[model samples]
Target: MGDGRGGGGGNRPAWLQLYDLVGKIGEGTYGLVFLARPKQRKGCIAIKKFKQSKDGDGVSPTAIREIMLLREINHENVVKLVNVHINHADMSLYLAFDYAEHDLYEIIRHHREKLNHPINQYTVKSLLWQLLNGLNYLHSNWIIHRDLKPSNILVMGDGEEHGVVKIADFGLARIYQAPLKPLFENGVVVTIWYRAPELLLGAKHYTSAVDMWAVGCIFAELLTLKPLFQGVEVKATPNPFQLDQLDKIFKVLGHPTPEKWPTLVNLPFWQTDLQHIQGHKYDNAGLHSYVHLPQKSPAYDLLSKMLEYDPRKRISAAQALEHEYFRLDPLPGRNALVTSQPGEKAVNYPARPVDTTTDFEGTASVQQPMSANAIPGGVTAQSMAGPRPGPRQISMVGMQRMPVGSMAAFNIPSQAGMNLNPGGIPMQRGPAGQAHPQQLRRKDPAMGMQNPGYPQQKRRF
Candidate 1:
C-alpha cells in the first residue's frame, strides 16, 4: 500500500502507509477510536486517539495511564495495545488495539433493539466467565478498573481476536498501594448507574469491591438486555446529593444499615445527607425483582455476593470466577464470539466507522508556564514512584511540519523549504510515547513529561 501522501512517499516511515483506515470505531469524551486495517495483517486494529484536553497541552494523564498498563500486561482477556501513533500536528495520541467486532454494550443494544432474538444461556455464561477472568487479573495486580461498564468490554468473532472478550479502556484504572492518598480524592470515579453503593455514599478509602459491584450490574444487564440499576444522572450542584440515583438503588436493594454495613453511616457525604433518609424504608426487592429468574439459582448467589452492600463483603473477582453459576451444566466456552443460542448461528456485528483524510502523524508543542501550581495528592502515571517501564514503539511522521512558532524555542523551516523525514526509522518514545522526565523542558505543569514521544530535529535557526 502506498503512503497516504501522494508524492515523496518513501521520505517517511514505511509503516505509515501500511495502515488503511477502515472506519471510525467509536468516540468518547476521551478520544476517537478507529478500525484500521494493516497491509500485512489479515485483521484490523482498533486505534483509539485520546482527545487532547482543551485546558492542557499534550496527552492527558489517562492516556499515559492506559499505555503504561496495557504495555505491561500480556493477557488474552485484556485488550492489547498493539501500536501507538500520534497526530503530531494536533498533539493527539492514538493507541492501536487488537480490533474487536463488538462490545457488550453494542451486543446488548443489538439483542434489544436490532434483533428479536435474545442472547442464549451459553453465550451469557461464556461472556461472564471471560469478563471475570480479565477482572481477576487486574485485581490480582492491585489495579482497580474504576470504570467497568458494558461499553468497556469488547468481543471478537471468527478473527484473530475472535471468540474472546477483552477488557478495554483504562481511562480510570489506578494502581492502589497502601499509604497512598484516599481513592475518592481523585474526584468522582465510575459511571453513576453501575457505581457501587459505598462509592455513592462517598467512601474515601475503598477497595476493588467497587469494580465487583459494577460487574454485578453488568451481569444483571446481560440477563435483561438493559441496565440493571438505570438511574437518571443529575447535573452537578454546589451541595450535590444523588437523591434520584440513590432512590433507584434503594427501591430495588433496600437500604443499608449499621448491622449489614457497619461503615454505612460513616462516609463523608452520607453524614451530610443523613436527614434525607432518617426513617425511610425501602424494601429489598432482591435480584429476582429486576430480572425474573429462579429464586434458588446459583446466578442469584453470585450476583448477591457481587452487589453486596459492604465493600468488605462484596465478592472478589477471583471468588466470582469460582462461583457455582459457572460450574452449572455446560461450562463456559473458550470463545464467546462463536458461542450461539440454540438453533441459531452467530450474528455478524458490523464494521466500525472511520474517517479518512486524517493526518494522525504530528507532535504536540508545549511551553509550560512556571506560574502553574504543583498538584497535591495527585496520583498520575508519571508521579508514581516505581521502576519506570521502557518506551512504547509508536508510528510517527513529523519534522517536515514543525510547530516552531512563538510557542516553542526550537526553530525549523517549513515542509517546502526543508526535508526532515526519517524515511524508514522506527518511531520510538518514552513510556506511553512520552519523553523521559530527565529530557523534558518543563514550562508548565500539564505537559506530563513522563512520556515525551515527540521527534528530535536539527534546527538551523
Candidate 2:
C-alpha cells in the first residue's frame, strides 16, 4: 500500500481511480472531502477519503467509528452514508455520503458579510427543532455526537423558504451506553468552542447533555452572527489573559455564583480560571448583546437551559423537542410532522440480488463481490470470521428470491432473532437454523431510506 501523503502511490487504489474526481469540497486535518459522482449512484455525493500511512496511524479510529454508527442509524435528520470503500494498496479509506449544498457555518458567515438581518426567529427555531430531533434519535440509539458545530450542521437548500437542515460529520461521535473513563486516562473529545463546561472541567462520567451545550453555542451564534466564546488570542495587545472573554457570557446572562451553579466550584479547572476574579458583576441589563430577542422569550429561555453550567440540570434533547419555543403557531401539528414533501418520490439504488437458499439467517454469510461497475476498480473479496457451520445443504424447499435492491427497504424487527454477519451486518433468522421465508420478499423503497428532497421533517412550530 502507498502512503497517502501528497497522493503519492505506485498504482492508485481501484476505488480512488474509479471515481472521476470533480473538485475538492472541504478539507480538514484528517482528510480531503470531494464532490464526486459514483459510477453506480445517480446524483453527486460527497466522498471523504482519509489519509493513511504504510504503518497505519494517520487515519484515526474515529473514521471507522463514524461509519459503524451511521450504518445502523436510519434517521432523516442525520446524514446518510452510501457506502465505504477501503483501498488496501494505498491504505486509504473512502466514505460516500449524501451531498448537501450548504452548511450552517457558511450561512452564518454569509449573513455576517452582508450586515443584513441575521437568521430570523422562524428559521432559527426550525433549524433548532430539526437539530433536537436528530439528537433525540441519536440518544435513543445510545450514540453521542461529541462534535456538534455549525460546520457540521448542513443545510439542503436556500433558506427557511425552502431549505432543510440535517446533522452531519460524526467523526467524533461514540456509542455512549456507559460512563466514559477519565479524559486523561483515555482521550479528550469535542471541539473547543462548543465544548461543555463539564468536559472542560475534566468530568469523566458525563451524559448526552454535553452535546446540548454545543447546540446552545450554535444557537447563540446563529442568533448573534458571531461566536459565543471567541477564546483569547495569545498575540493580542493589552496582555492576552487580561482580554479573556469568559465573562462575556456572564455579562449577558447574569453571573452564576456557587449558589446558582453549585458544581462550578468543584470543577477541576474552575479555580484556576474563574475563582480569583472580583467584582465580576454580570450585566444582563440589555438583551441586544446576546440575541436580538426579549430576555423572557421562550427561545431565549430554552437556549439558557441548554447552556447551563451544571450538566445534571441541562435540558435533554427529547425534552427540548417538546419545548413551547418550537410550538409557535402557523406550523404543522405535532402528529402531522412532514417526513417527506407532498409529492417527492424515493430513489432506488441498483443492487444485486442474493440467493435465498443460503443460510443467511442466524449465521454469517460471505458477502458477494461488489459488481465491478458498482465499485469502480475491482475489489478483492474478504470473508468475515464466524462460528463454524455444519457442512450440509438443505433441499430447496419453500425458498423465495426477492428482486435486487428490494429488501433494502425493510428494517429488521427488534424482536427478531438476528445474528451479526461476519462483516458486522445484521441478518434475521427463524428457529432451528431455518431461514425466514418472509425475509425474501421485496420491501417498499420508502421503508428504510431517508427522503432525499427534504432531509428532515419540518418541526410543527
Which lDDT values do the candidates have, in the order given? 0.61, 0.54
TM-score of each: 0.74, 0.65
The residue-by-residue lDDT of candidate 2 on 59-79, one tens digit each, is 345565555566555554677
Candidate of highest TM-score: 1
Error of 1 at 314 (Å): 0.6
TM-score of 2: 0.65
**Prediction RMSDs, each to the true structure:** 14.2, 14.8
Tens digit of per-residue lDDT, candidate 1, span 1-461: 15443334455444456676443435676866655567786655666777775656655666755655665554456776666654445555567666655678878887898885677777787888878877776665556889999988777654344556778788888766432456776677888899988777767788888999999999988898988887887657532566777788888888878888888879876787766664668777776778777778888888888888898888877767667887776567656756444566767654333333333432211212111012111111100011123332221122121221221212223232121113211223345434333221322222111222111211110
Candidate 1 C-alpha RMSD relative to the actual structure: 14.2
Report the Cα lDDT for candidate 1: 0.61
lDDT of 2 at 265: 74
